[model samples]
Target: MPPSLRVSQRRLRPGSRVAIVSPSFGAPGLFPHVHDLAMQRLQSELQLIPVEYSTTRQVGATPRERAADLNAAFSDASIEAIMATIGGDDQITVLPFLDSDMIAKNPKPFFGYSDNTNLLNYLWNLGISSYHGGSTMAHVARPGGLHPLSTSSLCAALFSGGDFELYPVSEFSEDEQNWNDAAWSDPNGPPPSPLQTSAGWHWHQPDRVITGPSWGGNLEILDWNLAANRWIRNNPADYSGCVLLLETSEEMPSAAYVFRTLRNAGERGLLAQFPAVLIARPKASNIEIQPTPEQRMQYRQEQREAILKAFAYYNPDTMIVFDVDFGHTDPQWILPYGGMITVNGPQRQIIAHFG
Candidate 1:
């Protein structure tokens, strides 16, 4: 488990062919208009020819059907990269059908996050490095257009091949666009969630620099992995030097739930492995569960406090970074799974090695 193996090449030229799959939730299948526009942007904006497999747009496809598409994408010599359309809950179910040897042999770049965390972790154990962000539905097909921050971060990961700094942006989105309505494409979708005044990244126990390959994702998904006893290493030593990247999604689990999830990991002796942790800003409100501004602020504050309490009881010395805009938040940064991250506490800088 977690062996030291050479990673695949990251030097993909513009116009290189890429494959898009729906290994998780098939937003492309549900919203073909959004999917088509995203493909068009991949070609026109990124100058990449985006190809789809059989299950890419098939909403009713089974887990095996989706896994087949993933296998085909990775095995295809014509495809330089593979990306997920959106994320859903059942990616872990698709994992059993995955051909690890086939994926390890092919070793192409895979991009996604959220429930895609399942696949990312699977790839990690196989010695495959992947991009932790850049889902086609979320960033590429965003309402106003592809975000400059996302596009830039993705390009650095795709081409530059090493050592990229992920800077915090001044503005971020707290609301999501209504895909059911045509307004996202009609150029009138609430002006991209209104640019809120950003307060920047919050630091905890920032007394020393910690640099290492990154691991972990949507905390709930990791909890699912732990429960399933799949992909994760049996021994805790495998994660000894990795930085933990944890975040919650739109599901907005309560602060207590977040604490308990980590507490469970701590109980397993897994939380103490990392010298540092990066927690994304908690997405407090969803369309179904709308919270007032005050409530939203309180939700995040409580979640942050919960994490600190858990860490204090587990890995109290770990350097904790909070409210990083990487998870179920707007204008997210594309991080690398199993790639290197350098956290300089003295300079207060966080850098990612995309390659």
Candidate 2:
């Protein structure tokens, strides 16, 4: 591991307090019932207390206001950790307002994904490790209770500190409930989107093993960061030996867009820095964009090919794993950003170290 990268050893006990802040869109404000359910689960399921901030449910809060909430969370001694209510597109705007020095001095495990990738990468550049997964509103407040796999991996990331082996789930779904529909708040509301059987993980160049700190997040967000040259290291070698964590969002970007985004990274001399990459199962169908089953399968295939094409151009020797359940996918695994991950290609296994 690089000396610059720092992993927190602080683990949450049952009674610890976790601050829930909305550093992005205030989804909690829009769906307080779902957000309340998530808060309740934080106590009933995890046996931990959830503390919300001023902007936690404040829709249309400015970027500075969001940053203020985050800063407060970091500075508060009683708060052992911080978790976002949900992710939004404008989190990048909040980045410049963050108090990096203060956050670096008071590092804690941050848990959120999608647009939260902006904050995750910010913390990474400061050498602080965080968890990459969906927000409380999106995951914990899931209509049909939490997915067993999500709970299993989240527990590992939150309370346990060890090498937890990543597992392949039998079934998964990308469907989301319409929050505006009152049924979503009903106990007997419609069941979650139909579950599809997983084909399991696909491995490429499984001839060697690579263990390193994981980086990267939603592909689109990474592209945004790259375009802005925000917190990314100027010298790509700073990422040498790191495992790249890649995933798409609910937007369902085309294979061409995925290829171009990665191509941009490769053009920046970025892709060659990593020896291994873990691509999350792309979210094929969403509430807005519903495609046929065959189309969904075809989408994933073309996406995989696009990724391989990018790697083939920049780093052909890279070990690649596709459809690891993380990011936008349900039954997701919470990966440690900037923490150690072992990509055992020959063993066809992955182990994430939640330090």
Best by lDDT: 2
Which residue pairs show backbone clashes in model 1? none
How would you encode candidate 1's per-residue C-alpha lDDT over 173-206 as one tens digit per residue? 7777677876656632335775676778999989
Q: Encode model 2's per-residue lDDT on 22-141: one tens digit a residue.
A: 998998897888888889888988999999999999999999999999999999989998899888899999989988898899989999999999999999989898999848988888
Clashes of 1: 0
Clashes of 2: 0
lDDT of each: 0.86, 0.89
Error at 116, model 1, angstroms: 0.1
lDDT of 2: 0.89
Model 1: residues >4 Å from true position, as ranges? 187-190
